[model samples]
Target: MAFHKNLTRVERARLAVTKLICPITRDALRVIPLTDFIFGIYISSRYRYVYIDNPKTGCTSLKSAMAELELRGRKSDLDPLNLEVIHYDSSPLKSFVPIFPKPTLSNLIKNNYRFVTFVRNPYQRLLSCYLNKFDNSTAKDNPQARRMPRGAAPGSFSEFIDAIIGQTDHDMDPHWRSQSINIHYSRVPYAYIGRFENYATDYVTTFHKLGIPADEIPTLRHLNKTGAGRASLHEFYDKKSQDAVYARYQDDFVNFGYPYELPD
Candidate 1:
């Protein structure tokens, strides 16, 4: 991971520590069935809130905001450009595992600590994933590229859909994984479910629900912007691709109340 020369002493120290710990921690967590869910979950003991991360659904922005809140200042703010720092294990926002015991976690869940997550329209999300990973020159290096079916074309939206359609969420990368599986919708009692389409307003509402005062609520910084810019859904989706995405992510459509048909 590249570190910015502009990073402060404390930030550099934190990043160094994160680099040392993440590899060991990730290797240990790999055997657990709940690894994905556990890693995605960020809980704030001070604020009594939990944020479940869903990739490609404004996760970077929301996590940065959460980090700001956790630190109690925007000063020496998180570098939106560097994901490693934002996701550092030393951050005030802690993940579920290695931090809370099962009994303690159960009690927190039973006590109704606010659980929150954001999701995007599957149609848009799939296209975004394709554009960001498969369509880019860096496609060959991405792990997802290796998962593509033998004959599938790199950067072909329809082919990308076909590749993931046959795989279960557990086998798929989180970038294109089903939202329901990523959020563990049935397993966790989410107090607020935000929409990426309506992120600007929904995030503020989420912060309010988390009991953050209006003045103290961290601003949602738009970061890691990817996918063909200003591109329309029609540019990527045709009948086959659209239907396949809808079929694969039907649970997301039904659970999140997103319409099946593309918007004009």
Candidate 2:
């Protein structure tokens, strides 16, 4: 809601009127439905740092880190020199969604705004996703769990990896950097770049560089959402699945400096 800070008083007033013309409510604008097509302009104008959620990339923990840095409020009185994190509950690559068109991540970068993001190794990430789908907490009632989606329970972890890696239904973009290019070696000035493996150190360094105090950082839960539920990386992915994940993500691996060796 505070992301509307870049708007003029008159512009904000006009946006309010425009909202009334559509399905309008306070919480709707705040959190309920996460979409850049609906609220991108407001968010981009207010926050300089944008967290592009590519799903299952330790997003909850990253959001907590941003909140700890006091970037959640509707308005920030802090100096413009500080980082303003813009979080998207959904993927910003609107082309995948029929109702929404493409967003302007390229334009924002061209404007010289500082950007940062985190990435997880794809093989481990896939394993974690399978475990989450079958994790008991997801369905408290045994009967309800029976109604879960197909491929939710592939029986074995290897089967789950085979299913996910074998299928080509989902988006292939890497979650770490905003774009698929050379994420770690970008010549542009980035405030900070983080790895999911070393989140605490990377997070603290980013905030410190931004002049935020150590006390301002909050404790986190679910910090290892990237790979916490996996029983064994070796057992989960076979050589084929490992090679597929690596082949598909080679660009991201080389660009972000992630280890690209196929799992043995």
Candidate 3:
């Protein structure tokens, strides 16, 4: 047992001593340099950290904030010395599997970086994903396209609800929150959490707690900017379709605190 190097004193000395022989690795380490002290101290100071992104959430804004911190040297963004950020887009499981045994989260927690994530209402998320995939020419031509709109049909929201509710294990990307919930049946201990409706307040409050300056918090960017208003959408959904959709996303509705009012 490597004696859990992140926590133990002996392991720290071993890593430090080992670095002297590995000069190439040592030089590389300088850029994102992490000695045992910095790693241990960082983990101790932070509250908690976990960015559970589930597409549709305002991830770009969060990424920008993190980039700023990295530039300042107050934190590192994939620094050769410290690969603190875990990006799912590029570093897929196959590439990262061999390094799984290493203490990854231990360093983040030690460094005072808090875990965070945002979730959108399932109904709206399904709608956005469906449109982004089929209605758009870019996705319509792609082989990986999951659900293409039928014929000259406009891909009604009703159809979107049916596709999601009527399938099992259908989503290609195994969502982080869903998998975590399935495995643990507990909400992840996020230092901050945000929902689509209240993202502005949540975003500012969360980073403020993390010591980000009030003036620096980025404005919330709505990805689905152009739309007929929620009231119009509410009028568009019929009672039967609404009921079915609610039944489909009951888990998300409950867990994420979305209100579902059956049409009168």
lDDT of 1 by residue, 205-258 (tens): 899889899999887788877754357889778898888888889999999999
Best model number under lDDT: 1
Candidate 1 to truth, TM:
0.78
The C-alpha local distance difference test score for the whole of candidate 3 amounts to 0.45
Pairs with steric clashes in candidate 2: 2-74, 118-176
In model 3, how large is the Cα lDDT of residue 37? 15
Overall local distance difference test of candidate 1: 0.70
Runs off by more than 4 Å, candidate 2? 1-47, 71-107, 110-112, 135-137, 140-153, 166-190, 209-211, 223-230, 260-264
Output the lDDT of residue 108, model 1.
Answer: 62
List candidate 3 stretches off by more than 4 Å: 1-48, 72-99, 104-113, 147-154, 170-187, 216-231, 262-264
Task: List the candidates' TM-scores in order.
Answer: 0.78, 0.55, 0.57
Best by TM-score: 1
Residue 52 C-alpha lDDT in model 2: 41
User: What digit string (tens of lDDT, one per residue) describes model 2 on residues 1-264?
Assistant: 222436667656655654454332232343222232233222223334544444456655655555544444535443222223323323221112111122233445555545565566666655555565554235644431332234244576555444444333222112211224323224334566676667668766755654556876556555534344346677666677777767765666776677866333
**What is the lDDT for 48 in model 3?**
38
